[model samples]
Target: MPIPAMTEQSDPLCLSEVTAAALLFDAPWRRFGVVGDSLSAGVGDPTPGYTNKGWADRVANVLQRVCPDVQYLNTSEFGVTTARTVAHQLDRMAEFGPDLLHLPCGPNDILRRKPDFDEIEKTMRRMYDLAARTRALLTTFTLGRAYVVPTFPDWDERIRAMNAITRRLGAEYEAVVVDMWNHPVNDRDNLLSEDRIHFSTSGQAVMATEVVRQLVYMLSSRTSE
Candidate 1:
């Protein structure tokens, strides 16, 4: 069965009807790049045809529907940290020269036994600087919902601290920030997979919808200026 496209009328996690309409972009995107860890590599979506079809793929599909010329590339891997991404993924993502770059790291880093905040911030800044050099519309997100918070008693605090740094980095680097804490999708359940660590199929759809909405709004606003 084909996964249904997200529309405000049919969306389970709808923020508003008009929000979907706003995602209809006037100017098309050419190239889109994705960087991060397993989420970016699409770990939980499915292996329908032996390919990991996750949220990033869903977002790319939506972009291609409106802008067929858009090319997509994802350099994310499982268990990758901000430090590893800066060392391994940043240069390659910049080489892609995507019109828009979606970066979602820090999850893997924060999940570690001993996460170094200073190192995380520095590595993230390096990644941000590399993206800035490309002049691509760099975007990132925060984690406010974790299914396995109980497993790691201290994870909530670490996630909160990480989110703060993410917002600050977005502001300092002028990258687009997807504020998940304020997004309506958080109100919904069954979005996460059985493990609760990764997004479920439905969750992936919501995420893709959010990414498209933000990208369209950001691009349109820039064009108007």
Candidate 2:
């Protein structure tokens, strides 16, 4: 079946909605730190009617609204792999001493001709371990099914493996996992950017909304405990 077109108006979760969802968390985080690749950096093409900000920036914006003192730092670089993130970004994020941290996934790790799943997992574990040391509430996103690379016939399989690692580690570390593998947004024809890799700004908006929702759930679970 052909995918449907996604416009800014039709988006179920927009930046405004992200703001509303973030407000649901009464306790404000003082420091928000993000470290990883372009996804963590919120790199994507701007959709005509959507906000140009990436998911991290949008989330940070709403977070700042609730707590104007929130200090935001994003050390995400384009095309950086999991290993690179560990070697480079981890220490900086640690130094930032964030109370809320967004971890990177394994997208760049799976981009090569022969991705070593074991090594990818190892590096990812290292990142998670180090980030967890800060005692911050960790968060991550499982890659959406719409993020595809046609040149690689096994792209779906790679994404699945990477997402599995993400889910497993997220659970192990008690992180908020925003599972988007089967999201309806993935069925949108325009979900991807011109690079056919990253999601467009419309998708980013949806992601920000989901992140806030997950954070709210986490907070609620904590309150119930």
Candidate 3:
């Protein structure tokens, strides 16, 4: 079957698809926006109308249940690397502003022979600017174990370094970071698609547990302060 094109009004997150179940938490947060690459784009899983694995869409689902007032924007583009991530996010921030921005990106950057770390940093800085302009709380998603292998020389180090950069960007911008470098969801092969890079529909559901757990906690922490 052919894949249908996603729409602007369409939601890219699918916490429901993430089957971990435990990561889902109840909390109150206003509407938000999500930005990133293919993972955030919900590229792999097939769910007829919507691929139920994008963490952004999943968080939106959880928010709808926990805080109906919560809304989110998904600005994900398939095949978008770190360079593209910053550009796309900055552009989106100009239009559909959100209270929060959930970003999931960087894998593609590692695969490239010439990783543009400097360019990546510049883009992240720009992302921070958009976050400021939108007054949108910023947050991010890290790769699960499947995405990284520390034993490797070039790939692992570069990925970890990029992750460090991501964390730094989050902290500098005063944003929350959702780190999933090693999670149990990958145990189930059914959750991972053939590509291995992308999560299986079932696997996406498991990832949702992490996304919601962290997001709701962030909202709670904000409220406490």
Better of 2 and 3 by TM-score: 2
Query: Residue 38: error of model 1 in Å?
Result: 1.3
Give the per-residue lDDT of model 3 (tens digit) for 8-122: 1243333342332334344434766767788876656553343445555666776666556676777777777766777656676557767767765477666766677888777
Instruction: Please identify model 2 stretches exceeding 4 Å from their true place.
Output: 1-10, 15-22
- Tens digit of per-residue lDDT, candidate 1, span 2-50: 9865543466653332344346556456788999898777667441222
Which should have the higher lDDT, number 1 or number 3? 1
| Candidate 1 all-Cα RMSD | 4.9
Query: After superposition on all CA atoms, what RMSD does each candidate show versus the true structure?
Result: 4.9, 3.1, 7.5
lDDT of each: 0.72, 0.87, 0.64
**lDDT of predicted model 3:** 0.64
List TM-score per model, in order. Answer: 0.83, 0.93, 0.75
Worst 10 residues of 1 by lDDT: 44-53
Runs in model 1 deviating more than 4 A are: 1-9, 14-22, 45-53, 223-225
CA displacement after TM-score superposition, residue 98 of candidate 2 (Å): 0.4
Q: Which candidate leads in lDDT?
A: 2
lDDT assessment of candidate 1: 0.72
Report the alpha-carbon TM-score of model 2 versus the true structure.
Answer: 0.93
Q: Give the per-residue lDDT digits (tens) of candidate 2, residues 1-225.
A: 987655556666554744554456495689999999999998999887787889999888888778778899999999999889999988988999999999988888998998999988988998999999999999999999888888799999999999999999999999999999998888877788999889989888889888887887788888899
Ranked by TM-score, the better of candidates 1 and 3 is: 1
**Clash totals for all models, in order?**
0, 0, 17
